[model samples]
Target: MSAESPPGLDLARLRSRLDADRPGLVTGPLSARLIEGGRSNLTYVVDDGARTWVVRRPPLGHVLPTAHDMVREHTVISALGSTAVPVPPTVLLCTDDAVLGAPFYVMDFVEGTPYRRRDQLDALGADRTRRIAEAMIDTLARLHAVDHTEVGLTDFGRPEGYLERQLRRWGKQLDASRSRDIPGIDTLRERLSARLPNSPAPTIVHGDYRLDNLLVDDTDRVTAVLDWEMSTLGDPLTDIALLVAYTEGEALGDEISSVATAPGFPPVRDLVARYTATSGRDTSAMGWYLGFAFFKLAVILEGIHFRHTQGKTVGEGFDRIGASVAPLVARGNATLEED
Candidate 1:
């Protein structure tokens, strides 16, 4: 492969990489534009001579270790390609730091919009909203149904202590991002750890399953599931619980007040019912998992809040994340106690 002078991640490098690996790869001059709104990673749309591609990489500035594993992200998506799940086709992976100043992966740029705001949800008609919601649940069910052994991911994560490790991991993250002691975080953490639910069998879990992390086509079908940084082998119910926490209940009502009052959005019970019917897993344990997901998200948001306070993140959403911490903790406690 002939190495050209590293261009400023413009058409030159994009074309060069594609040409080197996929000799007949047709593309257009790379016109790059940033896809704004994600708190964790930086995403860009790069159009080559004829086709558009997406490049995902870690955010700028200091990053935590193993936080953004591009290789793992690429691997999981590539593995899912043969499955019933819908995911963007991963085209190339660039591990060399010299290319983009960080490890990154390129995927077939999907032509769809990600719902980032409640307004976007409102604009989508009730029928489309319901279809998209059902699609999300179905996609997640298919994901959890994938056989890890067949996907060459039997060793994807240590499932022996999945819940325990998750509690510890986020607990450590909370400590690292501690700005001030929240009233109930410590107590919630203790209760969550003590009440860790039993696992049936380890299944692939999308750590951050939510409406915003997905892309929907004109038909309201989910075209791709984005942001696999926190995906791992664990109780798949955790994924369902996260979906519930972020979408179904009053928690989401608090996050997006307008949506809570909307007519189309399905309730938490209906979502759980759909998941139970599709996945056929005993969801009686869902309460514990829901609590855990809320606690985990609270810590992650708190981490962002910490970064924002340190001037690491420059924006409005992050600065307000701390406000959700207490509510999230309370929501978690409620889930644990829900009969």
Candidate 2:
């Protein structure tokens, strides 16, 4: 091993672990690069001079450890291997921090596009873009349709009071990152806290479900759902609300996160209707969920911003994360009040 290993990975040590655990998985010298960063765990594309795999690990010096449970992410994905939801095939899940400086998982590298910007969707054209968006929603409904107990996930998460815990958890996270006064943020929290709905029957919830969090293949179908660090047994409608909230927002700062803003993407109402039709669940009371989604995103960006300010954030795109928080908080307050 040289002194030039990447910040979050030690290729030599990784090779040793893979050899000891799985044997003959690597073919040649290993290489890696940070492929995703900012608010969530760090993702990297590591190659063995022949095959490539995606690796996920906690962000460098992340504030919360429980939120980035690599074992839980791997467990849910591995459990869903025989199910309808498309997830990258699991190759390895390593918890021994001595190998990579932290726990991480490796899975087969699936070929697809995350389609995070407007121009990317524009290139796909209106009809194709619409189809991909529909597929994204349909895939989510299908994921919600899976029975956790049958999939051996009966102990994955506590279904009872999931919403209340989320509200309280994200509220504390927001307070932890409060560097400046954010108008209407406290009011938004209060309203969500007061009007919390009795959650629907719990299912597998992808805590942050959005177009960018999914990979679409050439057929415009969702090839794989990435970033399952937040997946758990909880109110599945929360997943729908978060997706709709991200899709329907008019302003999410100056960032080019406009995959949902691309022309011809179906309206959020149509998405909600489609989900309700497919999932056979009542979503008339989703307004508060949408509000909570906005609040959750606001707090997430604030946490990223706080880390960026501390020089602890590892990659690009974090410069504007702080600026995006206030607008999201305001939108959350407005959404709750509108209903």
Candidate 3:
């Protein structure tokens, strides 16, 4: 790629800053390509002659405070470099807004495909798909087993009442973003609050742990676990639950008639078993955690629906997402009852 600046970025200023940061560092003609998939952040693939890098910044227009803390994201990824987890190498973090009009971080871009749907998995073959899934689970188990204090993440999150704060925080977010009151949203929130599960010792939890967030190589190994924006110290079960929620009815155990054919992924029980074996943690309360995960994702999707109703969301899918919230809440309630 040439040293020319890519569209939507300030080339001259960025070049100047780069020159100042590392004298004689070669940055050839820069071409910016917007990467799709995420709705909350603006991600670009920038190539400068000899090397390619990824830039992550907040989306344009109004945004919530501390919503996209690039510094925090950069810090976490940088810290993970020494861990067993696979993470992209962070090159630079620019808190100075003058460069990109917002805080941004550049990291070495990893090459792999994100598994977003069943077709993608099928394309990779059943054996490869299963291997990738297992690798993902193992990677998450390793992350949760890491000692936060040893890795300089002890101060990353406030563990005291973390679950309570999350419940309140997301509840407030839903209230602020709701365009219309869907049936059962209030009841769901109330039930989630009342049935808060027993809190375990805090560990690093990836708030979103779905197939789409992972990059799998041809050999079915996880090249990288992307999107650490929602990562923090919290109940490790929270991470496991989110993984279960993403696979619920879609991949885990028996397929639900309401949903389509199973994605052929391992059952949640087996996943928990693997994690327990790897991390030496008890699996007794996994059901409650899975319920919590579904409930949280439902609230978040509802927020997207609210944005869609206000004509804020682009493209299709948002219209029907609001309808899934109730089912997710019911799933959560059912899990709690089972416990």
User: What is candidate 1's lDDT per residue for 91-163, written digit by digit as tens?
Assistant: 9998888767788888998877776555677787787777777888888999999998898888788889889
Model 1 lDDT, residue 272, Cα: 90
Once superposed on the true structure, which residue ranges of model 3 sit more than 4 Å away at CA?
1-12, 249-264, 308-323
Off by over 4 Å in 2: 1-4, 36-38, 254-256
Model 3 C-alpha lDDT per residue in residues 126-195, reported as the tens digit of each score: 6676677788889998888789898899889998898888888777767766666566667766777887
Q: Sort the candidates on lDDT, descending order.
A: 2, 1, 3
lDDT of 2 by residue, 54-125 (tens): 888888874663678899899999999899999999999899988888899999999999988888889879
Off by over 4 Å in 1: 1-28, 248-261, 314-316
Q: Backbone collision count in every prediction?
A: 7, 0, 7
Evaluate model 2: give its TM-score.
Answer: 0.96
Which candidate achieves the best lDDT against the true structure? Answer: 2
Candidate 3: residue pairs that collide? 2-29, 2-30, 3-28, 3-29, 3-30, 4-29, 4-30
Task: Indicate the TM-score of model 3.
Answer: 0.88
Worst 10 residues of 1 by lDDT: 1-10
Report lDDT (Cα) of residue 279, candidate 1. 89
